[model samples]
Target: MVVIGAGAGIGLETARQVRAGGGQVILVGRNPERLEQAARDLEPIGTATFDATDTDRLQRFFQDLSAPVDHVMVTAGGPFYMPLANMDLAAARRAFDERLALTLGTALYSRDKVRAGGTLLFVGGTGGRRPGVGMAVMSAATAALPALVANLALEMAPVRVNLIAAGFVDTPLSASLLGDQLEARRAELRARLPIRRVVGPADVAALAVHIMCNDALTGATYDIDGGQQLLPH
Candidate 1:
């Protein structure tokens, strides 16, 4: 299994779940220290250091693969929260790299690495399925990934490709974005969810592991969002 953007939250939890299920995990990320630390935490698993946005490095990383991998879990993207009017060019580039370009690059690279009957799971956003302001580029790019994943599912044939559209996940990534108001934001967001609770990384991880190991599920987008996407604003 190959986990892209493996860092401190969903990716790490997913790696644990996959390992528990007896899969040989390979973690990928741009941060050498963080990647190495995550690999150490995941222990005995493989690790690759490469920026998803760097096409050359991504290509080389894939080329260096010794054998075909079974599962490709792409948690490569992160949200870029900014009002369109206030957003700068650099911010826009970050959004593109994190969401759109990253997915395309990872998929293109994983095109060969994924084995027959294998699975490619992309983590998309709930905001994307149901759009909102202040999250413009993140939503758009995430929404686009599922369509691409579906097409890839067809083209890749027996290799399944799906997405886990998560919502309001309380993770390090979100904490960094939310800053001091993280808890407050989580409380407010949880109130709107049908489950009336903010989901943790483990919740999303469980669903991801299930989807990756399941054979019959392909081109499916699991709304693992505590049913918040179903509610109206």
Candidate 2:
């Protein structure tokens, strides 16, 4: 299994679960230091350093995989928390590269190597489904992710393609976005969710693993948000 964007967020947690399930995981990240630390935490697995937005480098990295990989999970995207008016065009472009372009590149470079019946899971967010003021670009890219998965699933018959539309979870990525208001935001989000609690990384990881292993599932978008997306604005 190959996990792109395997930093300390959903990607890291997914690595942990895949390892726990006896699956060999290769983590790819942009920072060598963070990648090394994550690899240590997820010992017995492999790690590689590469910028998720670097298309050429990403293609090279995927091509160098030991052999045909059974599963490829693209969890490379991060939050670009800025109001529309304040959003930086460059930063938004970078975000799209990691979120959407990376998926495109991965499919182009590694699609042939994905064994028949193998799975490709894209990790996007609920903001894509229900756009919020500060999540414009990410929301747009993620909302299109499932559609891409659906299209890929059809074109890559026998090779399943699906998406995990995750919501606000307690992770480093969320921490960075929420900042000083982390706890306060969590509380606010919890009140909105039918479950009445913050979602955990483990909560998302479990569903991701299920999608990877379930042969019957294809082009499915599993909402692992604890009913947060169902809440009224």
Candidate 3:
């Protein structure tokens, strides 16, 4: 297995899960310090530090692989939401491009590097599925991924492709995104979400590992949002 963004949160937790399942992983991250810290805990087969969005680096990473891997889990990147009025078109384009490129590059390269029947699992979100004032661009991206995954799954053949769409996971990114309002958001989810609790990184990680190990699943968008999508906004 290879876990991109393995430094923290979903990626880190998924690495731990895979390790616990007796699988060897090559961890990738953009932050050297955090990646090194994560490596200390899992003792990954190898570790690479670079932004996954760089297709050149991504291809090189696959080319340099010591051997074929069983799974490639992409947990890099995060959501960007802003109303059209407030949006910076260039930045939005870059973010959207980076997201698509990372996933597409993963599928393109993994076709050769990932063994037959292996999974290319991507982490995305269900939050963007809901149309809201600040969600225009993200909604498009969200709608784009599953369709892309389905097509890639076919294009990639026995090498499966899938997306895990989560909502409001309790990750460092979420804390940073919410800042002072983090607790309130958590409380709201706990009260309103069908699961009656906050969804944490471990929850998403567990789902990711499941998708990776399950060969029957492919070209599907699995939602693991503590039923957050079921409630009214």
Q: What digit string (tens of lDDT, one per residue) describes model 2 on residues 45-146? A: 577898877889988887777788888888876666768889888988777766777777877787877899998888877766666787788677877788
Please list the C-alpha lDDT of all candidates, in the order they appear.
Answer: 0.81, 0.82, 0.91
Model 2's C-alpha root-mean-square deviation from the true structure amounts to 1.9
* Segments in model 2 whose C-alpha atoms lie over 4 Å from true places: none
lDDT of 1 by residue, 123-233 (tens): 887776555677777777777777887887898778888988888889988898879999798887677777888899899999998887789999878888788767767
- Clashes per candidate (backbone, < 3 Å): 0, 0, 0
Steric clash pairs (candidate 2):
none
lDDT of 3 by residue, 109-187 (tens): 7788989999999999988887899888788889999999999999997999999998889999999999999999999
Give the candidates in order of TM-score, highest first.
Answer: 3, 2, 1
lDDT (Cα, 0-100) at 84 in candidate 1: 73
lDDT of 1: 0.81
Model 1 TM-score (2 dp)? 0.90
**lDDT-better candidate, 1 vs 3:** 3
**What would the TM-scores of all predictions be?**
0.90, 0.91, 0.98
TM-score of 2: 0.91
